[model samples]
Target: MLINLSKLLSGDQETITEQVTLEMEAFVSSIGTFPVVEKRSFPLKVSKIGADKFLIEGETAVTLDIPCDRCLTPVKVEIPLNISREYDKNTVEEEAEDENLIVGYNLDAEQLIYCEILVNWPMKTLCTEACKGICKKCGANLNHSSCTCDTVELDPRMAKIRDIFNNAK
Candidate 1:
């Protein structure tokens, strides 16, 4: 979706409101591509603040299918996107402080949504707080089932203390 700033720039309307639907199925990030489980509707509002300045604001909710960091299970995570940007047509590329702000007459709605998603995405996603990760020996999901591997629960620093106690005995 491309939003034309001509109306606001030309002083035809003080503000413009539009309900836009983003049909993007996936978003690519450094982690990987996260699939969108639900499409979102954004209520976008653009208001002219000055002769060459505009204020853009919107809110949206989206659900994405991402793998749990521990178990790698597909988890549906809901992300809330709150967008607020000031567009300055007279701003130079070097003078702009925010990279997400629009500088030209045309604004890419999808790209802005993508930027918000990336910004709000969690560093680590877990299906549950008590999720037991996969077993190190057998590669079995500990949350689903138990593993037969004779896993020892030990602290390496206490090994020398154990030896001293054995010698006293």
Candidate 2:
């Protein structure tokens, strides 16, 4: 998925467009294997903006199955991505001050797509908005059903006495 910009860097004002499709499956340390990401084939429009600059824009829809953080349930999520990158013939240091500057003379499109998806990933994933999670007393999943254990409220005044007896052991 690498794009060669030899013609664009040679002062050519002509635009080059391409259609890309990618399927990626990678392992994630904390979350196990990353779910298969299926991206619909779409066109990537590349146009020369300046003699030494080019604008790359495209959009793609992706389907992913990720595990919920709370209950480890498989959640199906769809992500719509619109990406735009600017390629410059000049070195990146020349435009280091610009925050939106993306210097690419020779770049891999798959790497760029992976990075964009990573950036758009949610900070926390849950199966439902109000997931009750697991119970601390009996290690039961509260989302499935309520536990039968009695809910107790300890008296704060007697906490010191309980601590003294606990220390005696």
Candidate 3:
């Protein structure tokens, strides 16, 4: 949703409320393939704070199907988003050091909001804290049960150490 800043830029204070859905599949770069992110629909409230300045506030709830790092299993994670931002027509370099910071001027409001969501995504994903990863010996899943192979066969370098222990016994 593109917010028309005509009134706000003209020094007229007004409040604009909007509801829209944004597809964030393309914004996710950290994850190789875009996890299944449901369309985000939320209420956005924008109020003109000053001439060429505005404040944006909104909340969005989204469900994501992410892969676990340990077992590679799909895990459903819900991301509840609440954000507030201020925008000014003057660029950062053009404004004084004490002036309020500005994000986007010519960009659409929805696009800027979507970008914020992408920045808040988590880097690491885990299905559970106790998730037993794949076995190192035979590549079996340790979560289900232990493998029959001897622990010594897993690493050939340990065979000599095992023989020394047997000789000591």
Candidate 4:
């Protein structure tokens, strides 16, 4: 969605409000396609802060299917989005990062949404808080079934410590 900020820049209105839905299936880093189920809607509001500066704020909700960090199971996760960006049509700041400062009369809503998604996404996604995780012995998903493997493998670097304890006994 390309937001034409001409009116807001011209002082035609103090603020402009619009609702938009993003339906693109874009590949995300670490996570697969975002909003694996449906489109995401954003309720955005843009206000004139100065002669050429504007403030944009919005909220969007998105559901994504991501692999659980522990069990590697595909889990449905709902992410809440809250975004705010400052824009200056006249000033171009090279140090300003994306979403923090936008220049020009046209605002790229899709890019803004992508930025919010990245900011809100967690580093790890788990099906449950107490997931058992997969078994390292047989590569079995511990969350689904139990494994009979001894599962007591120790690091080779700690062999000296184990031998010292054994000799003490």
Candidate with maximal lDDT: 1
Error of 1 at 169 (Å): 20
Question: What is the Å distance of residue 133 in model 1 from its true position?
Answer: 1.0
Error of 2 at 120 (Å): 1.5
**Model 1 regions lying over 4 Å from their true place:** 89-104, 150-169
When 2 and 4 are scored with TM-score, the better candidate is 4
Each model's lDDT comes to 0.80, 0.67, 0.63, 0.74
Q: Which tens-of-lDDT digit does each residue in 1-169 have in candidate 3? A: 5655554555564877777566455445444554545656777777887666677788876667777777677777676667677766664345343133333332365465545656566677788889887776687766777777655454556778888888999
- Candidate 4, residue 57: the lDDT equals 95
| Ranking of models by lDDT | 1, 4, 2, 3
Model 4 Cα shift for residue 139 (angstroms): 1.9
Model number with the top TM-score = 1
Lowest lDDT block of 10, candidate 3:
98-107
The collision pairs in model 2 are none
Worst-scoring 10-residue span by lDDT in model 1 = 92-101
lDDT of 2 by residue, 1-169 (tens): 6666656667563777778666466424344666655667788777788766778788986667777777667777776778887756564455233323333555456665665666667677788999876777787778888886546655787878898889998
Candidates 3 and 4, the one with greater TM-score:
4
- How far residue 7's Cα lies from its native spot in candidate 3, in Å, is 2.9
Q: Sort by TM-score, best first.
A: 1, 4, 2, 3
Judged by lDDT relative to the true structure, which candidate is superior, 3 or 4? 4
